[model samples]
Target: MMISEVSEKFDIPQDTLRYYERIGLIPHVNRNKSKIRDYTEEDCRWVEFVKCMRSAGLPIEVLIEYVGLFQQGDETVEARKELLIEQRTQLKARMEDMKKTLERLDYKIARYETGIAQTEKILRRPET
Candidate 1:
């Protein structure tokens, strides 16, 4: 299929797809005589993977490095595993921080509710 088809299928913009290809996030796409990109199923799969990584908050630089390693054959398996492990660790730490922040917000919300209830009770009393 063509670039347009791939973009429509993946719900991604055509320009973004082109940018990804230019930046080496996805492998090189075959070109037709008119120099237009002709994407194959494999190319589409890579594009989908890239979209997933981006959605998961993976940095573009890390994706680029992954693509490079992927193109270099199977010898970089350990390095690739290490990269994923490091990212997982960072994500875990971020999740922990978010949990703490959420707890603080919940506490503040409960405190505000209590204050509002007390104020309502005071307002219901006979005026001085």
Candidate 2:
């Protein structure tokens, strides 16, 4: 597929895709006769993987390292796995922090709701 199609399909912008290629975040994409990007299935898979990792908050440097290891052949399997495990651990900690923040926000909202209700009740009372 063309770069535009890949961009639409992946919900990523063309410039970001080109940046990814330039930064070695994804492997080199093949170009067609006219020098337009022709994304193969493997290339799309790399895009998907990188997108998922990025959404999960994996650092760009870590991903670049992982991709580098991937390009070095099968001998780097364990190293890649270790990198993924470390990222996963970081993601879990971040998730926990987010959960706590959400709970605090919920509590604050509830308290505000209660205060509003009490004020409304006082306002609605009959005046002498």
Candidate 3:
């Protein structure tokens, strides 16, 4: 697949895909005879993995490190596992914090809804 096709399929901007390739956040993509990127299935899978990690709030440096480990072959399996575990732990903490914030917002909104209902009811009452 061409770079544009991959970008469109993944809903990622073309330039960002280029940047990921440039920074080693994802593996190098093969180029065509004319020097245009020709992404293979494996390359597209790499792009998908990188996009998933990025969506989970993984840092660029960490992804670059993970890709670097991946490129080093089987010896880095344990390292890769540790990296993913650490990132997962961090993601979990962030999710918890976001959950708390969401709960607070829900509470505040419900309070506002109740207050508005009361105000509307009072306004609709017949004057003494």
For each candidate, the alpha-carbon lDDT, in order, equals 0.94, 0.96, 0.95
Per lDDT, the best of the predicted structures is 2
User: Candidate 3 on 103-125: residue-level lDDT in tens?
Assistant: 99999999999999999999999
Across residues 1-128, which tens digit of lDDT does each residue of candidate 2 receive?
99999899999999999999999998999999999999999999999999999998888899999999999999999999999888889999999999999999999999999999999999999999
Candidate 1, TM-score vs. the true structure?
Answer: 0.81
- Can you tell me which runs of candidate 1 are displaced by over 4 Å? 125-128
Q: All candidates' TM-scores?
A: 0.81, 0.97, 0.98
Q: Give the clash count for each candidate.
A: 0, 0, 0
Show pairs that collide, candidate 2.
Answer: none
Q: If ranked by TM-score, best first, what sequence of candidates would result?
A: 3, 2, 1
Candidate 1 residue lDDT tens string, 38-124: 999999999999999888788999999999998998999989989989988887898899999999999999999999999999999
Scanning candidate 2 in windows of ten residues, the lowest lDDT window is 52-61
